[model samples]
Each structure stands twice: as structure tokens, then as C-alpha cells.
Target: MVLTRSASRAAKCIFKWLPNEILHLVATELAPTDLAVLCRASRLLKNIASPLLYYSVELSTSSSLISFARSICQSVDASLPNSARLLEVAKFTDKKPPISPRIVKEINDALCRLIRLEVLILLQRSIDYTYLLEHGQFPQLVVFQYLVPSHALPALTSFLNRHKNITDLGFISPDSLKFSTPLSLPNLQSFMGSFAFLSTLDLTDVSLTHLTLLLYPPDIAVSHAVLVNLHEMKMLSTVEVMGMHANERAILHVIAGHLPHVQELVFHHFTSTSSPISPNESVNIAASLETLGELRSIDFGGVGGNVIEDRHMVAQWSAACKSLTSVILDERQWDFKENDWVVSWNL
Candidate 1:
């Protein structure tokens, strides 16, 4: 209480002397709680503090999410004073007496008013809030991610078409392989989602630079459509793949074949049966790396049973790919230093 009062008094004392630009800068540095208190100090302060208070919001529980929704709904005409640009909800938990329809409507209404939102991440799988997306059109929204409902692909497709400004997107759900529509995002630059999801999109015209694929057993068999898209991405430079069911060597080969110009490669969470790659396999992998003339860094941090720290293996890769500068294996980093591989423990 004392600290809050002191902050309020300090803000009031400075408001009279400081310029509005200075006040805006100060408000940006204040925590959300302090910003809320500043809003109550005076009308001038409220105007300055309200925007920062709502600029970036992160809700982690049902109660807080409901309160935030209600607060926005109760604002002037349930619209003004909204300047939220980034909103990330951890999840909507399942407790007895679930969220009511009234609450949902309020959330939907409040979301519609946040026209300036740029990044929206709904990390909840329990509630399919995908419907709320249908009610709002965020003109500045560029990045959107949510747990998609298996039946909401049409709605998702429609949303993407309306928001052509979106460049980065991700949505994981059961039966994602059902998506067959030829979706297009001319502005898309980076995407992170299931491999099955990537195969369904028509992105041959898009110049993607970063790609992250979530793999499963079924995704091991790379589709022709996926290969076509990969081949078409002339600007792609970074790639990250995570899965346990696929062969690491085969995955590397495919990447080398289509993305010979890739600069950074990461193979995460792959549980390989071969622990320390056999001499023959190491030779073969190095031989494949030779094709990627632009490859600068390769990481296999969480690949189970894979020993990427072997100096001999690192040396082979460095020899095969002269551009290789950094290698990460099992939390250890090896950098090509002065004609030798230098080891750095990341763990």
C-alpha cells in the first residue's frame, strides 16, 4: 500500500513538470500494476497509462481472463481505451462449472475492439476459442497461433484470407492432415507447425526464410507437395525439425536435397537408435553435408542416443562443408576455431 501510494504521488508530482513524451517513456517502463495505479491518479495520467497497461497482456488463469474480458467490455462503449498489441493466454483450464456463454460473448466482444493487436497466442487446447477469431479483424495482426479445432479449418482458412498481412502462423490439432485447401499468404516469411499441415498449403509463390516442422510417425514419409514447396522456397535459409520417429540421416538427406542453400539447421528431440553414429554412417552424413555449401551451423541437441560431440565427426563435417562454423550436439557446442574444432559445454 505504501509503495503504491508513493508511486502515485511521485507520478502526480512529475506530471506537472514533465513533457507528455517523457511521461509516455516513463509509463512504458512501469509495470502493469503501477500503470493501473497511474491511471487512477488523474485524467491526463490515465490517458498516458491506459495504453501501456493494455499494450501487452498475458493471462494464465480462467479467473484473470474473465476479469480482463469484463474490464474491456465495461470500458467506454466497450471499445475505447483499448490498445492491446500482444495477447498470450497460457491456457483455459477445466474446473467444475465451466466458462458460461455470457463470458464467452464478453471475451469475443472485447477481442473485437482490440484492433491494434499484432501477436495473439492462445495456448489452450481445452477450449476451442477459434470461434472468437471469426468475430475480430485485427488489421495490424501479423502473428497468430492457437490450438486449432479439427473442424475449424474452413474458419481458419477464411480468417487467413481476410488477414493477408499475417506472416507467421501456427496451429496444431488432431486430424490436421485433413486440410487440403490451397491456402496462400503472399507475405508469409516464417511458419511453425506440423509437417502434415505444411504439405497442405500452396506456398510455392511465397519466399519463406524460416521453417519449423513438428513431425510424427506419419510425417516421416515426406509428401511430393511438401518437397515442391521446399524446392520453390529459394529464399529459405533456416530450418528446424523436431520428432522422434524419423531417421535423422534421411531427414538430413531430404533437407540437403531441397534446401542446399540453408544456413542453419536444427534437429531437436529426435530419438535415434544409433547412439554414436557408426564410422560408415558418419562418413555418409559428412558426404551429404558437402552438398550444402551455405550451411553454417547444425545442431542436434536433444536427439536421443546421438553423440554429436565426437571430434572426429565434427572434423568430418567441417572438412566436408567449408562454410560450417558451429555445431551443437547434446548440449555441447563445437565451433571451428583456427583449423580445429573448439568445444564449449552448453549444459
Candidate 2:
């Protein structure tokens, strides 16, 4: 059924008169495209909805990046209060080529005007962001994710040192192994990066609560260093180990000693045959778990049946930790209810 022009106008008028809180609630549910269209209804609506529309800006092509940068630069009041809080710069594989130098310059210039930007995600590896980092463009950044090359590590380190307010950081720096110094991040609570980077961090002053480590094999020394660093972080409550290799029983022991306060643990073990863990190694893992008295939840994957089904392993793990609240094996989960483990295999 199509509405008459008068009826549409009446409905819009009614919507415009709704309470500000209700309107904001409604706006939160709208997609970015819908929110942009809604901003055209009235000046009041535009003022109320522009922030939501521009909260997260993703430029997937050089054209969009250059166009948006030009548009924002042309505006007399480029430093708008409702500037985008999150900005993502990346080239789509199926779309245009990588961002050109001119587009990169525009993006940096636009970032300077985004005074309230909180998160900056850079997936473009070729772009030089040293200028943006040196300039106080993203003064309010709390979360930063970047793909760093070896040459850019020094600049990235400098940026991280200056941004003490950053609470979450994710990096993919395969070439860079160590920083010049232990850059202090007093407010950092979550970190996601390679095991090499994690091992090099001096987190003595940082109170990290969540950590995600990307593991690699044949790096026993690096794994030991990572565990040593984890031992210093007494506030950690959650830990995730991805690409976990076999024969890391000693590493598991170190984890139990270091992350005593960790309540949740997830392990995505490597299934390659080259680093197969023995039954003895599984026993060591069970022994390590017994030491983690505060552990309430644990998830395991890709580890052999010897570790998962061993009677001593399960019995000791279940007996030593009275706080066992949830256990996830393979794709199934078990929750403790009435002092008995209840399976939820379907989930």
C-alpha cells in the first residue's frame, strides 16, 4: 500500500517530535546507509543522526578515500564535533588498485581533522603513516590496529610510546622482532600480536586483562620469554593461544604459574604431525592445569585424544580446581550445574 504525500508528511512530523532518547535508540538500530538517508529529513534530525552515520568510516577504494578526503577538506568547518570515531583504510581485492600517494596524503590530512577519532585500523602496508603518527592527529585513540613492516617499526614504537591512553592494540609485524626499548603503556588492557612481539614487551607497568598470542613452532625460547612476560601481568583474566604447537608442556607449566588469575583459557593447537605431543606431555599439561586454582573455564581444540580422554588428566583437572565452571572440547561444551558436568554437545 502506498501512502499519500499528506500522510507521509504527517508521519514524518510525528517522528520528528519523538523524544531525543527514543530517536537516538531508533538511530542506533539503523544501518550506516539508512542513517545517511535519515540525515536528509530535517536539520534537527541531521544534527542528531550525523554522529551515528559517521561514527565508523571504511574506505575500501582509492577513489572513495580520495573523494571523502576532498569533501571533508573542502568544508569550512572540517573539525566537526561528530567526526568519525573509527577509520579504516584498506584496498578491496576485487575493486580498484592500492591507494595512490595522493590518496594517502588526503587520508592523513583528513585524519588530522578527526579530533575525536578513537580507533584507527590500517590494512594498507605500503602507505607511509610516519607523518600522521608524528602529528597529533589521533589524540583520542583508544584502540589501534596496524599492519607494520620492518622499516616502520621504529615509527610505530614512537607512536605507541606517545599514546599512553591506548587501551587495545593489535599488530601484524612479521618482520619486526624487538622494539628499541620497553615502551610504556599504562592504560593498555588488551593486546593481540605475534608471540615474538609479546615476548619482547616489558609489561611490568601495564595492567593487561586480555591477551591473544599467535603461536608458532620451533620457537621454544620465544615461548619461554612470552610466558615470563605473562608472569608479570597479575591482572590478566583471559588468555587465548592460537596456532599452538605440540610438545609445549613446559610452556603450559609456565602459563599455569604466570596466569594464575586467568579465568578463561582457549587453546587452538596445531594439528601438524611434525610436532606431535606424547602421552607424557599430556600428563604434564594436566599437572599444569591442576595448579591453576582460579581457572573457571577452559577450551581445547586439535590436541590429541590422549590428552582429552586420559583418566588421570580429566580426574586431576576436575578434582584440583573446584571452580571449574565450563569446559569446551572439540565443538562441544560442558557446564557445571549442581556439582555435575552437563554436556551441551549440540551447541
Candidate 3:
């Protein structure tokens, strides 16, 4: 599109009058499509917009992913000093052909240049492409979540050891449970995985503050050894358990007995569980609460749903656990108000 002489002059004037910082601020608000247009407008605009364009890349489609990988591999644009701080690559469909071995190599090669990356997430069922990420050298990466295969554990260990900046880590693969190597990351703060996986790691020196234990189907009980290891996490104050089975009471008992210093407790019970938490079970729950003097809040929003309707039981809990400031029973939120419990429904 050719602009008239007057339009071109006005555009030049606008660009000349705007400071680079102001132009950068405007560039940040532009969508990628708009940013691309801005980049083509002028050399100055291109320099201002190109970095923002690649700051965060989330590609879900096969074509887009391949195109992005190719661009990164071919990137000679010095304006983009480093690659994206956040990169999320997800394969949404199973029907599409698997990423070719050559493309996989290209992707891995491209990822190596993303040394400034702070967050990397891979959401795909197959480990074919993800296993290659073990070679990635994202030293600045802080959060990483990927499904790792058992065979790649050795390389993964080396990858993780090299990147000590990672604080929040999650493993979605069941094969991650087989990881029993001695791993250490002093700066690590949050971990999400199964109890078996947690037990396998020697995180005794790592001061983890948040723990999300996935127990869907409750395949393996939270063993005594796991609890013993969990108790050693002195900085651990928040605990979330998502699943249910016959050992619900035992789990609660373990939490109360082991992590007395816990401040917030959340239980998201699976809907697949046949038995709802009974009133008698609630009484047992209250009994467990009585021991948690430092507990500040307990959320059972997804535990028993509407089954826990007794306000009196909550009052009993509030009375027993003086530190309790908030209680979420399913959709209801009972907050400790000015000397009394005020009810608020979470609609």
C-alpha cells in the first residue's frame, strides 16, 4: 500500500517526535499480527516491535510450531537479544502425524538458543519430542513442566542440575516415579507430583514451601516413609491433596501429626470416589483439626460437595482450632468475623 506524500510526511513526523521508550510502550500493546505490521512499517519500529513479538511464544498447531522452530533456527535478528522468556508447545490432536525426527532435531536446536527462557511447558501425550528437551540449556528457566519418559531420566537429571534457577517443577508422567537419583536444587520452592515420586527424590535439603500431591485413584497409599520425608520439609506450610480412597482419615491424620506447622490445607477429592465424607468422618476431621493449632484455613470445596452442610460442626471446629480464620465447606465460606462466624456462599 502506497501512502500519499502528505501521509508519508505525517508518518515520518510522528515517528521522529515519539521517543523510543514511548514507541516501545505502544509496541507492547500491539497483537502479534499488528506487531508484524509495525515491524514492516519502518526500521525503527521493527527494532522496537520485534523483541516484544518473540517475548512469549505459545504454538499449539503443527504448522505454527514448525514455522516458529524454523524462524528461531534461522533468526539472525540481533534486535531480539534473546529468545522468548516463556515458550509453551502443545500438540492438541492425535490424528496428525508425529513430529518428524528431522523436525525434532530442528526444534531442539532452536531451543538451545533460548538460553534466556524462564518458563517452558510441553503438553503432549507422546514423549517422542519431549525427550529431546533433556539437551536444552535454558539456564534462566524458573518453571518447567513436561511428561518425561523413564529412559530419559538420566539426561533429565543432568538438565535439571544444570538449571538451578528452577523453583516450580511438575512432572505429569507416571514414569517420573522411577526417578530415584540424588537430585538437589537449593532454590526450589514448589513441587507437584505423586507421593511415590516425591519419596523417590532426596529433597531433604531443599526447602519446599508448597506441595501438590496427586493421588487420583489413590493407587499407592501415602506411605509412612513418604510422610517421614514430608515432615522434614520445615518450610512447608501449604499442602494440597487431590484424590480420595479408603485412607482419607489416615491421610488427614498424617497431615495433622506430621505437618503441625501447616498454615493452609486444601483437599480436592475425586468425584469418582463412591463414599462421601460422612458426618462421623467430619467429626474425625474436626478431631484432626483440633491438633493443627497453627492451621489458618482449610478448604474442602471439592471434597464432599454439599454433604458437609452442618454449621454447628464448623462452629465446633472454629471453637476448637482458635487459629482457624477461614473454612470453606464445599460452596460455603465461613469466615471468622468480629467475634463470630460469618457465612458467605461462593456462588
- Measured by TM-score, the strongest candidate is 1
| Candidate 1 C-alpha lDDT tens digits along 1-347 | 00112244445576665667878888889999999899899977887888788889988788878878877878773334347899988765536357777776777677777888899888765545655667678889899887777766777777887888888887666543547687788888888888788876668578789888777667767643475567756689999886655354457877787778799999876453425456787688898899999999998774333344377788888899999999887567888877778776657
State candidate 3's TM-score: 0.85
lDDT (Cα, tens digit) per residue for candidate 3, span 194-248:
7766766667668889988777444345555676776756689999876646444
lDDT to native, each model: 0.75, 0.70, 0.73
Model 1 regions more than 4 Å off: 1-12, 77-82, 92-97, 244-249, 270-281, 304-309
Candidate 3 minimal-lDDT segment of 10 residues: 1-10
Which candidate number has the best lDDT? 1
- The better-scoring model by lDDT among 1 and 2 is 1
**CA RMSD of all predictions:** 4.6, 5.2, 4.3
User: For candidate 2, lDDT tens digit of each residue in 1-347?
Assistant: 11122234346576645666777788889998888788798766666677787788887766766776776777654444336898888745445656678777876777767778898888777677776776744678999988777777788887887788899988766553556666777788999877777765667788999987765554445666567666656689898776544544355676787678888888766654424345576567667888788889887644444434533444556776777778765445667778666665623
Provide TM-scores for the models. 0.86, 0.79, 0.85
Ranking by lDDT: 1, 3, 2
